[model samples]
Target: MDEQLHILTGSYALNALEGDERASFEQHALASEQTREEVRGLSAAAAMLAYGVEPVRPPQRVKDNVMAAIRNTRQVPAEAVVTDGAAGAAQRGHDGGVRPGAGADLRLGTGEGSGPEHGSAAGAGAGTDELGARRGRRSAGSGGSGRARPGGSRPGAVRALAAAAGVLLLAGAGLTGWALGQSTENNRLEQELAQAEQTQGAMLGILTSEDAKVATARMADGAVVSVAYAPSLNQGAVTAHGLPELPAGKTYELWLQHDDVMVPAGLMSGASAGSPMMALLEGQLSGATAVGITVEPAGGSPAPTTEPIMVQEL
Candidate 1:
């Protein structure tokens, strides 16, 4: 048997192995009967450790918080699962399984008690046949009936049950925490999605409004430009459709011409087919008669350096 395989056996019993390691372990167990028996023995010992553990009482508000969170998360109402609080306490011989004030009379075995020797002795007549007899003797040693002993089967069984219950409670607490985290994340994402949808609707409404229209123009260089106008804002956005990219240090600048005075709009570094660029007007353009574009310096110049590369009558 590979040593790594044996190490995984413990993790497997605890349900900790994941992905390929877990799959490989399952395959190995399926092929090896000896390994399967070892897995069973290890599982039983693990169970004993899990059950013989002293109950850990979470905070007083933990249970209430968990239940409250569950209620908030579930969309539908259902019957509540009843917990036998009193019986659970009686069986564990405590007021609360894990409360600070709860009395714990159970003696938990550790070390060798958790070994495979103790768990896999098998049947009634083995070298450890005296183990059950020892339990009986210890029960007799206690000042009660031959039934109430520390290491007896009944006490061990009860401890196991209590341990299992404690494990379940802890597991539930973990699940609740994870669920709350996921709920918070989901709520955040939903809020973001809703905001995005609202923004998209508003943008769509703006795009289709009567004040907005598409305009097309041809440049002297044989490039075509398409622009979307927002008359209410006295602004228009343009994109060069199939315009050749300018060399480095060259840029496209926008202009608005009213009367004969040309006003600088804005500068763009590059243009791509159908890619929109914002063209912010320098001043009120309600009376503007024409829009034009010129190739200018990187940051743009106060006046045109050359004849208009593209011009469109509004």
Candidate 2:
């Protein structure tokens, strides 16, 4: 029982055992009448402490503000009554209040006598009554309901507008992100295309140089094959070591084959004796498929009379 009392004290301080320990404590509290009484006492003490520590201060102009609010509320109904003197008198009688007469009492600036000030007050009160009556009529037309229209906005309208604005802001951000991604991808593709164009131009320059030499061959039979030639346009030049030599009266004629038609490449003179030759082939080898050496007559043939002796796939 003493331990249970201690637990209740700790709970009051918000420092008791937690989780399973608190759950067990609660179960024990429910089972024992004494523990429940202790817990209740501790709870009451805690509440007293909480309330004591809370700050309490009167609102500024609270009296005037409250009075003003009450006055405003009553003004509507009071003005309605003043609109009809007979009705006003009847209402006063129902409330057991004395009705003021036009010549009841005389006081300076107090609408009691038949003076100008009294007349002025009467006129002003009558105006207030007429205004209130109009407001009462309007209220009655609206079914005497004090609540605003279902869809009508109040102070919470600002919050709704803010929420709508936030959604639009999020949508705008998403569109901006997508647009940036597409722009980056387009830039990357443009760079690749430019690089490809540059590479093509470099290849074209290499295929059309004049200081190019070519190896040539001809068939034993005189063939009317003309040879047009260009040098082998390697970065530096290809070392032709271990190449085979040409036979006598049958010079090697180089020919570039394009799309099933053989274009003439220049002739090769002298016996290479199986040694590599330092020669470049001529003409545009941009899109050539194969290079062929055919045998031709002395001084070279206009075309090939016989088949090629050697051919290299380019």
* Per-model TM-score versus the true fold: 0.33, 0.24
Which residue ranges in model 1 land beyond 4 Å of their true spot?
A: 1-206, 219-222, 271-282
Per-residue lDDT over 75-143 for candidate 2, one digit per residue giving the tens place of the 0 to 100 score: 223323322221233246555463532111111221234232111111111111122232122222333
What are the per-residue Cα lDDT tens digits for candidate 1 across 82-198? 121211333344424433312122111223344333332111110111222321122223233332222322221122222222212211111111112323444444343333222
Looking at model 2, residue 247 earns an lDDT score of 58
**lDDT winner among the candidates?**
1
What TM-score does model 1 achieve against the real structure? 0.33
- lDDT for model 1, please: 0.42
Those runs of model 2 whose alpha carbons end farther than 4 Å from true positions after fitting are: 1-247, 270-274
